[model samples]
Target: MKSLTNEVLHYTLFVMILETIEQYYTWALIAILLLNFSQRKIPNSQKKRFATIYLAALLLIFEVGVVTILTRGWPQKLAFLDLAICAALFYFFREKAWPFRFHCVNCNEKLDMNHIIGHDDNLCQKCYYEAHPEEAAKEEEKNKKLEPEQSSETLGLQDIPDTVSEIDWDIWEPREVCVITYLFENDQVLLIDKKRGLGTGLVNAPGGHIELDETAKEAAIREFKEETELDITDPIMAGRLDFQFKDSLSERAYVFFAHTYRGTPKETEEARPFWCPVSEIPYEKMWEDDQYWLPLALEGKKFEGRFIFDDQKMLDKSITVEEEDNE
Candidate 1:
């Protein structure tokens, strides 16, 4: 009776251990499936087929373990049946099941593993560049314009510069980084009449200098709220402005566009808030650069502009609008 009781306890412990392992395996498989499905870079059909095979294999392994535990020994016939089913599944879905491609789809060139897994197009680097000539050109241009390692010395000039070409932007550092946010609602945009500071009395978007350790986006949100008492949401970066002011103030401002906001716009000590129709922006009353780039921004375009400013008057300017990629 004692020997029989010990044997029963041993089987019970084995069953518990098997159940614990099965639970862990099930959870791990679920996590892998979720990760696979969430991946946007991989093809959907490939992800689904891989998930199916993985699930089937996991279920088969669990079934074999369960059968072995229940029968007090490994079920040889059941194990063999599971193997055969896996083999059949692999045979039927070989192309879909295989994740690695040995050749470029475009040029039939031999590809490394990085090309097979890293690229959704299954093309090698050379073939990829050939297929995307514009992207190749952009890459080459970017490589040619590498930033210099040394920073430029302060100009310390007694006279304010009159031309944008006087400053080398590659090594030029800004004294202050600022951010501006334009809130759009329907056909109107929120604008502020500056009451104090640099552009006092000029019409502009709500903006201020970035505080220490704060990101440009965070600073934009804070400045908008402080000036207009409104909480803006989903602020999308639209452009950047590099200002070389004659007053020895070098500023780089990141511009953002927000369409959603909460709270009402109220006048503050720093600015007076108002809603102006998109078609009727008072450009003459605002900074001169606004007339050139604000229109493009309203049309959902990205731009970068460099300006040499003498107080509120712009001396020289260069604006570049980025080409939109519809793809």
Candidate 2:
């Protein structure tokens, strides 16, 4: 009985539906044309899309309202509810019922209303690795060997993605750089809270980006002053760490420690500088490979490192600790 009622109602609505739809179509076309005529700063694609949606919503409301007005000859039973429901549906569809967007990790392409399979980094046949089989083979072999053969324990960290959020894997570009300055005092290595993007809420060395129009040493001094709020009088550059992470959004860090400085360390939004015993640190909360290479720096030793992380966020990573070529 319910099915019969639905079928009869559907046929009745279907006949009048075209006329109802036409009314809405007219309103939509006019609205979008007017929007284009206005010429706003909004991007062309966004402008057209927003205009279409706005028109569609108006169409729905007008169609339902007119249908009730025509059939009942005026507002009557269920007319208000029908109009309200149409408006509510338009709101819901516009705000919440949109399709999920898939982004290409390598190319940063966003696709709307489509599932792009095999488009991501190595998930499909047309992936970059497939185009370069030799490189892909080598990569797989190296990845297999990266893990320790003897024990389940791995030599380097495996949280690749989070560790290398700053690098462009397909292309090398140094957008942002950092300098980690460690102060050796009374058998304690000073560690500071990051107070910035990656490890903002986490503990890290007191350092920051090497800005333009400033020498690296000068940048280091400025960063130390800004973060630690301690003015270093004689911060002779000991060495540097070139942390290379394999990611699109991750950055290579140039870490430098100073043995000599002036003023007392204080707390700031960037970091609260304090001395930690060289033997103990909250390694779990730091850059995944901090402990492996930081010790060399703390021992008054100079070295550069090449660390790779899969993701652009977090410190989980794999590291190749080596001495710097320049040093």
Candidate 3:
């Protein structure tokens, strides 16, 4: 599985490199045409392409222009290559450009990107206004203003779909390293009943973000001590859970879980640690995704997956999957 994953990564990296080269060519060609070098037989389709690439290159250069396009080699070629890349990036992102075509994520159809350019991405821009008329009104107000587009309101507009049949690939996900420990005593497992914040009034495993200057295991131990005021010995490193969620407020969320906790249980305001039979877990009250995968982890399973949601901290639709357990 590791070898297969690496092979896939290598293939993806190679394709990206090839795409970059192609983009450079497209940009240079567009640049030459945009400058209108005399006596060039540029076709109408070519002109349309040039319009896309020229704009793309201009936008890309405006972004990466200052850092000296040159690397260790000759500066001139590097500059030219940079310009070409910008052009390709622009063309590659044509779905987001003007004369927009929004495709429905559920059912492919041209969406009105102009109508709900900000609020709608997963839905076809065309159908969003119809499916969500109220949201459409808000979108209309936004469009009428000719707003200069708020950066924080939307992070990856370039990745959103203007058409009805595409996916918004630019889901922002920054990775973090953390630990998970399943506190245990006899047959019962230790768990935390969260008392505050988003997942309040629910049961959870007793652990927090792995602290700084510490390994995941060390951080888990320290967090247990701080949150529960209990000393644990020999906390084992269980498996991990990779979780994600998205909503109107934020682009996405990622969380990890561990099940190898030790020591006696204690209660705290932040989280009440207790030992409960694994089978009797209140899975329904827990976050929507927990029931689907938590049990697998408790029984010692390693997993990774993407889950969609209507809100950041809450899960709406979850897809729990595992790599082939051939090993």
Candidate 4:
């Protein structure tokens, strides 16, 4: 009976190989089916050892299949030699496989044997490092002290996305921020020759985007210094304007009134400094909405306005201005 079973098994394997040799990958599928059958026939105590050998054998078969496809044609002698090598490797390493089970002590998570760094504590790599923060920090400091070695590893990876899809598009999206500043000396105001960036060539006050970690008030002060080299210690929040451009970009411009400042205004790459007589301010060269709201602000009124624009043309607009009756 045992001899009959052996003959039947050999005949089945031979027929499968003969049928699948011309088809290339079908032999791998047959091997997997045979492995499943073998696993069922084996006692439960021996399943793990069989599974490890099966996995290694499957990988070897897959690699040989890939090589055969790449070489375009497979010679019978080379194929037989490769099969013999795979069989020998499987036999040599079958008994030497690690026998220890690994699991995370903290989270009760099953872990791969390769991921087991310390068997005494049985902690996963991440949890082990976290539990020893002082050690982690010391290791980090040592890595930082490695100078050339550390620099070479991070030479190009810093601040660069590994793939185009990994880039966060929102960080590069268009943003509009309020840029308005009012300078006061008796009754005169400071206007800037809009030199480079947005609103270039147009007459506007000295203000710009609010930088990170700075309030709009601080931004107004910072922008004032960059554009005019003057510092405003106390800037009154005068009014606000909400503008929407045709391309869906929008901004809220916070108009500030600075009653005091230091340093003389000077020209820089971004703007040319100039004093405009309060009575003779250039309204035509300024933004259209500015003409409507400037008078209210000059009179110490608080206002809120909205403007819809197509390019430089104002498509729609509204304003509400009121004095606080400071009696």
Candidate 5:
């Protein structure tokens, strides 16, 4: 009789222990779900993906717990429900919840697992550097310090004559460095009838000489605003022009192209702004050299050209279309 009583007592104790463990498991699941939800609020893509994965795992655990409670045993055929749940989650959340990605979002380059799971952007190293150019610039500057210093060659040395053939372009420097920016919209490009500048009475893009402590791109934006009273953005370098004139005026011009600008083009003292069809650019009214390289620029090609001009006439010219890098 005493053994029978002891058996009952042990059975009751076992049931109580099981109940306590079940309660703890329930609380743990809730805590994990709460943590997953909180992590969803984070802006980091990797953390959000992790949270999604955690939520999926918690759902599976909950399924297993329900099956165990109902059957009083480990899942058997009910294990297939876990697989179904996985499929459903994948189907529904492939873009939003998947923790692993195989390629960069920007350039579509193959990404390793470290970038997949650890980085917020999931971009490959090259794409990452391209996106964060400041960091890349810093690294480039660091590397340049380790390399040999290059000689400083002045452009259009004062003694050099006004003949293009006589100039050694590799060592040539300009007496004045300038920039020109062309803004495009739809199928029309902005052109200016120069009112008071170097190309006065001629049609050209808004541009001017680079000022002290100014970068070529900065000069392009500033000159465009000053001449057209419009702010241009995302100016891309298209080509370089080296000019030698019979009057001994040697200049190097950087050409930029932009498709975005704010404010309406207003006539300024320097220019009368007007939009001309790309198919109808008044080449005859522009600089003679424009006919040669302007078409290339319109086609998004990079070029380098040298020209010798006698006043308004192009005396001699050489143009080479540069090969673009396959980024």
Candidate 6:
């Protein structure tokens, strides 16, 4: 009888210890989650202090729980719950999951898992330091520099606002020289399916980066032949376009308007040629800026323009047009 009584008491004691441990774990999880939530809502000025306080509290709870487990003994049945609490703390306190795929805020660089610095701010390590130079005090911080990776994520053109002035264009450098050739036949225009290079899979005019010692016009004609297997002589210079991608890679493209050309449009290794009607050009399949200046160019007007892009989405643009006779 005494043996059975002792067994019952032992079982009750075990249950009590498990309940106590679970309570501690539950409280800790709730606190951690609350701290994470508050981090977003609190002002930047208070964040440092709040974070410090949160860390101190978390450590205190951790120490107390450890001591209690050591003194009162481990509850084997509650191991799962304890492990679950650890996971919750890990996920909650480290970083919030991104609602959308990652892209840098300044330069539109895609982020790998480890380099993501924050939530929607989404600045990659390089741009983050560029924007915040004061933080780059340690050599270890420079080791976090982000390198470019090939990505094919396209932005929906419909989401872009009509006129955007949000981008700061001063930091962008004009490092690349390229050309764009628009060939017209009656009311139809020739374009190509860009097979490779920067805007792969996108519909664009037949042109490419200028080779060394090549004039912009020479590059345009060369690129035209190379991509479309057609020859266009004396193609009129229509305008100049300066494109600055969100990552600050800049290109100066000399836009050419070609009304007369030789040979039939054919596919090449670089691009696949197709003719699109002027009245129904697929702006959706082309770069976002094409919709802006292409119409004016098609009307035989010369234009000079600058376009800023966040990935494939147009962020801001400005253009000046001139009469054909004036140019």
**Highest TM-score model number:** 1
Would you list the rank order by TM-score, best first? 1, 5, 6, 4, 2, 3
User: 54 in model 6: Cα distance from truth in Å?
Assistant: 89
lDDT of 1 by residue, 13-86 (tens): 76676667556766766765665544435442354446445655655665565556546665334545655776
Better of 2 and 6 by TM-score: 6
Q: Write the per-residue lDDT of candidate 5 for residues 11-65, one digit (tens) a residue.
A: 6665565456555766676775665655555445556557556565755565565
Residue 68 shift from truth in candidate 1, angstroms? 15
lDDT by residue (tens digit), candidate 4, 101-206: 4778776688754434223355665666545432333444355456433322233434433332333322222234454888988868899999987678889999
Error of 5 at 129 (Å): 18
**Would you give me the overall lDDT of model 2?**
0.55
TM per model?
Answer: 0.57, 0.42, 0.41, 0.46, 0.52, 0.47
Candidate 6, residue 34: Cα displacement in angstroms equals 85
Kindly list the per-residue Cα lDDT of model 3 for residues 144-240, writing each as its tens digit. Answer: 3453253223435344332212333232222333444556656676677888755578776656654334545466667677667666666654333
For candidate 3, give the lDDT: 0.50
Q: What is the lDDT of residue 199 in candidate 2?
A: 64
Whole-model alpha-carbon lDDT for candidate 6:
0.66
- Distance (Å) between predicted and true CA of 41, model 4? 62
Off by over 4 Å in 2: 1-171, 236-247, 310-327
Model 6: residue 87 alpha-carbon error in angstroms: 99
Better of 2 and 3 by lDDT: 2
Which residue pairs of candidate 6 clash? 107-246, 107-247
Best by lDDT: 1
Clashes of each: 0, 15, 22, 0, 3, 2
lDDT of each structure? 0.74, 0.55, 0.50, 0.65, 0.73, 0.66
lDDT of 5 at 223: 94
Candidate 3, residue 170: lDDT: 39
* Residue 297 Cα positional deviation in candidate 4, in Å, after optimal superposition: 0.8
